[model samples]
Target: MSDTSGSQTNITDGQQVQLLERVSVAVVTTLPCCVFLFINVTMLFTLRSKPVFCETSRYVLLYNLLFADTVQMALGHLLYLFAACRLFLTYPVCGLLILLACFTTTIAPLTLLVMSLERYVAVCYPLRHTTIITIRNTGVAIVVIWAFSSLNILTRVLLLLEFPFKDLESLQMKEFCSGVYVLLGPRSKDYDRAFICVLFVSAGVAISFSYFGVIIAARSASTDKASARKALNTLLLHLVQLCLILSSTMFDPLFMALSGILTRIVFVRLYRVLYIFISLFPRCLCSLIYGIRDQTIRPVLMQHLCCGFLKPAVSNSK
Candidate 1:
């Protein structure tokens, strides 16, 4: 309801619709971003103190994915916070950020796909793991995925920058969303349907298939039945989580393809709301997965969270 920069916002005084929606998004965005931010920053600093002995591509991919999600959740959500605080700058802000978010959003699934492939290599070709897979190589590949994703986003941003957005009430910062990234004018509106379809489909398919291959390869490994079972169960949980995250992205295109106006409105609103909440998951869940599920990683987290505190206590008592 408060437009700080005087640039015009979506909701007017009498219209109570978007005001409530914006408030809801702000709450969800703020709470989760704070929690995930703490977890991610804590993990980054503790990585050096306790190292995981293995040096596989998947290991490196895991850390890099964390790094990427931290950026997306912490810094990216901060962008929304700024837009909320300074609503008047919505026009140019919308212009600059929407395009950049395209890249950030795109790279997430791509990184997941890379992780899946690395897992596949580690399991399927265990003998060739050292020869074929390296952390440095995975890091380079991550850079490549980021570069490729950025290429598309930069192009989208360039296309969007040329358009003249008059700033419609529903398009700018209203209730359901904080950032001006979704602002759609006559020219810019082309982005919603076909464009999102391409980006989401490609990334989702890549991620899904990569994991599918990993699951298959893991099952085929010669590890003991008990170890294989544990690995499969863990991988299944990861798959379900990844699916939830990827499926949420498809909502945009799905909404666009719908024929009914009411359905479209409801879906788009849901899309924006889900977007704010879902983006936080990978950051926190990645930490939990690496820390809780894997015998290899849980100790590292425990050492950092527990040993760091307990060591000095025992020493002082002695």
Candidate 2:
């Protein structure tokens, strides 16, 4: 209660607020995502059917997403936790944290793009999917995704850290470090804004077109309405998954911008509240959403978590 009102007091710079938000986000993201990753990794081995080309390629994409998600989640949580405890995102460590956040954000979107592409090939080119989505081909694609992400982040980080500002201390830091350029100064962040706008549009178009092409190509003269509807529902579930991914990423960006401005203008700790909500709720719910929407995914998850519950009833009855 007092935290909100006291936000304006004893505030020489933003370092205190930044520390608070970072710590809060650390707790929110770390435990939930770590548990989710451990369960998913186990299921990949134990629950999934044998690796045919389509299945293998799908798992490849999923593994990439899980790896990237957990990496990003851990980075967001741990880096901030350590920084808050040690105040590391300052002086010598500032550049390093910026570099890492850049890379994590980059990998996240690339993995999503790969998942979309994998689904496209499977749905659009079924007969050829077996040949096209080989282990070697998937390995190459995985390498390309990581390579492209690393290069993109490297270039962007270089551009960001090289901002003409002489004193980073003079600039106001926000919950998200990436927003250093966006609201920290009087000038517009044209370079980053343009870069992000282009990436968002490009990703959006590629996702849309790939799915459209798949649906159109898979359209058949002899196909029944029921089968078509089933295919369409499967696509919807993927779309749902993609929506969660997009929302989760964009939420971080939104908080970054809004928090930078609010703390700058009103001196209120609104960002603190918002940061906690965004970090905890979205990541946890997004992971659980996969289990909720897809019947197959839901059962697979339940079998792992609830098999013991089922066993108790059977034993009692017997």
Candidate 3:
């Protein structure tokens, strides 16, 4: 009897420990997410506050990129909270969340692709850049990116026809809500892998090409050395950002493979760490990179970030 009682106590203690750890992880992840969301929102407002940002082609593209990333970050964080809380949402609800998440996730790389090409044009053909990258074209490009991503989402929804949700006792999911559970069919998996591969590879090649083009342009006698250098740095940053964004998509499969080798406790701990780095960190990169690097945006972003305190001083100085 004493042995059985001791075992029960140990099990209860272990469960409590797990619960505490889960809560701790959630708090740690969420605090940074909230901070980034605040900064991103401020940056978005800063972009729209000035006429120059609205009129410029690159700023327009940056707005689109940042918008998609902000949505992605929010959805991803919400989904993470859902999983952390062990909430099993119904299929329809989960599907909507997952689809929205996937849609925004798809936009990041594609936007980066467009932004890279924009930089390439700016550096390689400075005279033609203004004509080629106009407001109308930027708007059209954003529409194309959204339309393409919508097609992918539509295909995934169609693939759901194969899932026999009718066989289940309820629409409520048996497991925690996630892309892995939501997309169970073989075709969905194959399609997802193929689509991700094609999208990332194309973006990678385009960005790389733009990087090289900028490097070559930098050496030319006619090229503005400073502009070429800046474009090179921007392209390089885009490549790094692309890789970080890509890492979030790859983490699930990698973690799944690691699950077999690692114990549950270790796996959960490692997953949280990777989740912070892979998922959360990448989403914040856009604001941090452009907010600090872009001279035009820095002062406005700072003013907004400081809650307009700098605005009065700047006006007084002016």
Candidate whose lDDT is highest: 3
Report lDDT per candidate: 0.58, 0.55, 0.89
Tell me each candidate's TM-score: 0.67, 0.65, 0.91
TM-score result, candidate 3: 0.91
RMSD of 2: 7.6
Residue-wise C-alpha lDDT for candidate 3, range 228-268, written one tens digit per residue: 99899999999998998888888767877898999988988
In model 2, what lDDT does residue 17 have? Answer: 83
What's the CA error at residue 61 for candidate 1, in Å?
0.8
Q: What is the lDDT of residue 163 in candidate 3?
A: 84
lDDT of 1: 0.58
How would the candidate models be sorted by lDDT, starting from the highest?
3, 1, 2
Candidate 1, residues 30-144, lDDT tens digits: the string is 8877877877766655554434423545556666666666766665576556544435444555546555655666666666666655555555566887877776787689889
Candidate 2 residues lying further than 4 Å off, grouped into runs, are 1-55, 79-88, 160-189, 217-219, 223-231, 237-253, 256-281, 284-286, 291-300, 306-318
Give candidate 3 regions above 4 Å deviation.
1-19, 311-318
RMSD to true structure for each model, in Å: 8.0, 7.6, 3.0
Off by over 4 Å in 1: 1-32, 48-55, 79-86, 165-231, 247-282, 310-318
Candidate 3 has which clashing residue pairs, if any? none
Better of 1 and 2 by lDDT: 1
Clashes of 1: 6
